[model samples]
Target chain A: MQDVHTIGKYADFAVGDIRTFAEACGVTLSVTLLSLLIGTVIGIIFGLIRCSKNKLIRFLPLIIMEPLRNSPLVVQLFLVYYGLPVMAGILLKDYTAAIITLSLNTAAFFGVLVHNSILAIPVSQWEAGYALGHGKFSTFINVIARQALRLLIPQAITLYIGQLQCSSIVSLISLRDITRVGQLLSVRTMRPFAVWGIVFGLYYLVSFPLARLADYLAKRIDYTY
Target chain B: MAMIEVKNVTKQFGDLTVLDNFSVDFDHSGVTVLIGPSGTGKSTLLRCINGLEKIDEGDILVDGLSVNNKKNLKQIRKTCGMVFQQTVIFPHMNVLDNLTMSPIKLLRMSKAEAEDKARYYLDKVGLASKEKSRHNELSGGEQQRIAIARALMMSPEALLLDEITSALDPEMTREVLNILVNLAKEGVCMLCVTHEMSFAKEVASRILFMEGGKLVCDVSKDDFFGSVREENERINKFLSFIGE
Candidate 1:
């Protein structure tokens, strides 16, 4: 009886009514993927820069990472969205701002992860590669990177999942993400439990497969000996 | 010119002086064993030749070029190949690649030229067919033979053997020694720093005895263990302490 509403709302929502749900899914996935690509590029660049012999190049990450980690992403998103328009005289979309904030902030995130992964390699491996007459950069790319990749994968997966979950909070600026769509439907239909049930189930559908895929890939990784 | 000249070379790590004003010349085309107790700077001396460890005092000339000077270190390294005790043969590469790397990289030989040269050393070490095998596929002696071949691929004028046989079993040691004998016969000037007294005697044209950090006595194998040679008395005392 508490679930009853008007005839139009009594029936469950149409499949195409889920277009907003589709848009939320597509938007969040697209943003996270772009963020990951950009974040990885930034991280690798700075990570090697961190290992550079030149003091100036090594200190570049210090300038980039400090403010990135200090401020909240919410505030970062707002600053980029508002400040860029004022300075450049060009209006930016919400998704563009979200990707930039996520990419720059997670640059430091992946940078630290990459540094620790590189240092984890044994000194003998370095000696062996050097003995083969590889210069430092060549040795890093050919030998060290291949070894470090095995360790970097799990941390990257964790970052991606976190990014996916964090995408929900981005709807605070009226972005129409999954959670926002669910909230809108609940208010319109006045059926909070059923509406949120559909929302929560959709998220599980997205997240559970990714977690399983990561687990499956983890099992396939060959670190033996 | 001396194949290798080490003059008053000293290496100090903080307060611990590993090699104290050590000077030696490697000129002979045969094994010259450096027999001493552990931590007696045998490996330190070998590393100095390969330009891996820089000496704090004094200079090293490899083939008459100063290894102490950074400019000539690479040139010196290309001419003097070193084989470590734990001579891992690049587990990721096949034996052929392991052998060919130095020739290609340091000697500037083309890949085809390097591989062709690698095959010669491979055959010399009796590993012609095993060239295509991954490093882990070989036995310990086989792996060491591959490592030796890898070192030789540089076509080095001199070789530094640092306790290379100490890790192997007796059978493996014999196999490695046979290869070294062949190398010595080819007139490759060698500075072999090893603890195997018997191998030292069999292969060495000369022997240098060290106690602590000093080369107390240098003698030929004929007089070394046959009759006690002239010593500083400290050498005799230290030799007895080690029960050698």
Candidate 2:
């Protein structure tokens, strides 16, 4: 019998592999950006609701937010991807499913950040606005929101970076993100170590610049009174 | 009618009563300085007058409009311009914008009209050149001055000052107090809460001394610093303790 343990020579990474990875990067970027855009808008609305003076209105977002925040991302992705089709007969594309899951997850975390940021401002600020003859809505828009935005920026950017990494989970749902491409490439080339190392570097490449931008913004927006 | 009337008002934080059946009437003019030990509800009274704190039982009326009625709040707040102990100028805005925002937005003044008024008040506050400056760039005194100017933009019926100079240094306090004295001389209605005895003497038309959420003494300026101080041991002790 011929020796069954003989290993085949591994294929070298080529220019074509770079093109494949680039396309995968595009998917990851789009998913992250789209989710961020949608997430932030929803998050702000949820935050305003969370900050409501009425006790009933304040807890309304928690119905949706709690599950998204408490559960595993993988489980959320699976539910949106597989469970939705079975339970609701809503046949969403894999990309759509990934975006929805990530957006909701991001919204949950971002909403909390926004609520906390608004609360962090001194009540004197609101009193000052009101005393100046502004109604509650005007005070919130003119005074509270402006101040809260400064507090929200650096933290929100950090959250965005986290969401970008979280986008990696979409690969499990067969969304062909960088991680999925890496897995495929590693199998094809028999070079798991090299493939994963490059994948890790790609994520850092995308996230490092954003982290720097957040730091710069944090410093720039600081008030010194 | 009184400028502000706190009628049978009671306020509490949980079980601790801050203001119990507190009733007072502020005249439409003159500076009335509220002096008290901390936690005596002087600030809370000011807050209640402007509809900042809701009274548990009874009514606060500003310009004859009841604070208990939600519809009256906007007018009440507009009439009572409050400056807090901690100077709070809207950050991230230029001094001009800070002064002009409320006038243009709430009062429906034209932008040009608002700017002109802002420039006038900026000059009055000795901050004409600081119009383009942000709140963070100003000294604490300048910020408080700007806060006063912001309140002035509304042409309020009364300016409710809650220890406006307490956060400032001696020099800064003098600068702020000088502005207050000028405003008082010009006959602007003010209800001030302060520990600055000299400022109170110079600017207060009437002095209100509060203790345990009740007004212990309400008298003319000279009477408060002279006979009222001599007669009321509690007032005398408070004045001594605060180094008045």
Candidate 3:
């Protein structure tokens, strides 16, 4: 075993390494934010399709969602990063592939969530809208959407946190995110504990605020209908 | 002309028939109260008239617009405003928004015009002060009043109220019924299904007794209360049970 003094010397990490980790974290955050935006839009559009009464429209979502949900997300990432260029002849940048895979995978989960939330609303709410001479589209957007949002927000936040953490997987495709930076620095510095601890701390710092925001929303919107 | 006409309507929930070839017509001038026990298709009849529940057979016309025709749905729904038993106000909106939504969205009324109309109905329902109150923040009675006001915002040709006061205390029930009574006096065609016997007696021009998805008796207020017809033993028993 190495002496404590030698280990302590390695623990005296350079400030440049910290700066590199910070930059990597910024990349992780930006990718996660962009992925979330993409996932949310895809989720809403596909979720409406899944909830549709039209047989053809409804089946379209099921076709995409079922396979995406059943298969492993990492396998999906690999296919997008490695197999897509060979299969479809469309070359994608490494970051583009990572973002697309993560967004699509998260969207499948969100699609299911939104579909179930729409179903959970009572039939009477729709009836009330119709009885008042509102069209189906107006009723859905004005009435059902508001009620569904109250239930959707908390569950969406929880899924978003999970997705945020899962975004670390993008590092496997050489996306140069915080996890990848940590892996590189740990190997170079030969101090896995010190390097990984800072990485975990950064993740915790970002995630704790989001979790608290979720709690605040849950409490603030609490009202019995 | 009749405000509402149900022509041999048949409504079924799969194998379970709720309304079995029932037919009725209401004149465009007075309050018509439907009295019946629970699950007797009274609510179903109201819902069917407003196009909320589809009829398996026959047709319903609201203000001479056929409810069976998909193209006429918007016009038909516009003619009849319905207040449900449970307070079905949108929980996320304030009273003004709840009242103004249908008028602004459906009638294409401007925001200022809709708010003006909403305030009028709110005042009519004795809830002028509750225009900014959240649906869930108000008491059950207050919520029901807001619902009534919301329906009135459409300036409907007829109103269908399904035991709207059943969930309220007596004071609130009287408060809501008073608004209905005033609307009745103004000659708003109304089809109300309520257990408030005194209020029914006071406002109803015609009383229709329903049992087993059929109208057992369609009698004038004087005839229904003044004469004891031996043929209506079930209705008499029901009325007496409710202390009517």
Candidate 4:
């Protein structure tokens, strides 16, 4: 009873601590941005491949993405950060491993969404282009690819928010993102309210606008079906 | 030689034979109407002539060149324009864009030239003022008219209309049939697959009766309506069915 009371009282005194909060936020933003950029690239490639008629080209991405999507991101990070060096003879720096792991995991989900959006484009659109003599590659690029990008925004933002939250797990890699600092602050201050509130609020600051932007863009993009 | 020759064309999808040894020769001028019961391959025959569907056996020739080769398809398709059963307008695009897309993209016309051509054809179809209106904003009749003008923008030598007015109201059908009559007067070779026997009798220079996956009867408009005993017995029965 005394310990809980003392811990809660002590954090109120240090709620004004700005330096540690800023450091953690800076790290969180960096990881999220890097991870998102890498994930989007991987997602677009595999998403296109999954819809491909060629068996050999399509199967390779399917193998990688399924396990990445079905398994835990934490487990993936451990493999890239820890297991690869031990078994696969590949060594990666902690931050690089975190970026790689986050990207791979996010891409597995992103690829499925992107591919679905592309498939949702009606067959008649392709027929119309073809009847005009547009070849296969040009048809997919001009018709299918452009519309898929426009449709992908809402999904992408949701993933980015997930990515921002997921950045916390990378602290296990010792990169010191915002959530890591909040955890340390909570332990020292023993104030769950002050520490968790500040951390969760900072995350909201990063993610809330993303959700809103996605909603706005999804409404704006032109699509027939 | 006939401009378009379909000889012993057999088309099958798995075990179901859609067209069996179906053959017809569509001349280079005026209109030819194909009348048939449903599932007799009238629409399928029209599609095969333009290479939209490949025949399983035998051959189809447009202007005496084979359409079976991909390399030859570009030149063949350019000469053949098709209006589908349903009004398939590019819904996202406006009336003018619908007319201009193939002209600009396939024919490589300048944007200004394409726009001018679109206006001319849209005016012909009586939708000159609806240039900025999207496809869905137009009525069913208006949409089908725009589809006609879009096909015309390609300046095809031959046009294949697949039940182009079947989905329309009577007034709308009249509007399309009137356009097609005027187009036929200009000597566009037209092969129309339709249930509109009255319209076909009014416009077609020749009429074909299809049944059992074959061109079972072929005759001029006058002889088909005239009293002739040697004319097809199956055709007589089919004609009586329609009359009833």
Off by over 4 Å in 4: A1-20, A217-225, B227-233, B236-244
Can you write out model 4's per-residue Cα lDDT over A93-187, one digit (the tens) per residue? 98899889988888898898888888877776666555545566766765566666677778788888888898799988877788788777778
What is the Å distance of residue B73 in model 4 from its true position? Answer: 2.1
The predicted structure with the larger DockQ, 1 or 2, is 2
Report lDDT (Cα) of residue A8, candidate 4: 69
lDDT of 2 by residue, B74-98 (tens): 8888888889888898886889999
Which structure is stronger by lDDT: 1 or 3? 3
DockQ of 4: 0.36
Residue B29 Cα positional deviation in candidate 4, in Å, after optimal superposition? 1.9
DockQ of each: 0.28, 0.61, 0.73, 0.36
- Candidate 2 chain A: worst 10 consecutive residues by lDDT? A1-10
Candidate 4, pairs of clashing residues = none
Report lDDT (Cα) of residue A46, candidate 1: 74
Candidate 3 lDDT over residue span B204-229, tens digit each: 99999888888888999888876844
The regions of model 1 sitting more than 4 angstroms off are A1-7, A53-93, A150-158, A182-225, B105-110, B126-141, B169-171, B226-243
Q: How would you class the docking of model 4?
A: acceptable
Q: Taking the tens digit of each residue's C-alpha lDDT, what string does model 1 give over B6-71?
A: 899888878888888888888846768887778888888888777778789998888788877777
Alpha carbon deviation, residue A153, candidate 4 (Å): 3.7
Best by lDDT: 2
Q: Report residue B64 deviation for candidate 1 (angstroms).
A: 3.4
Candidate closest to the true structure, highest DockQ:
3
TM-score of 3: 0.93
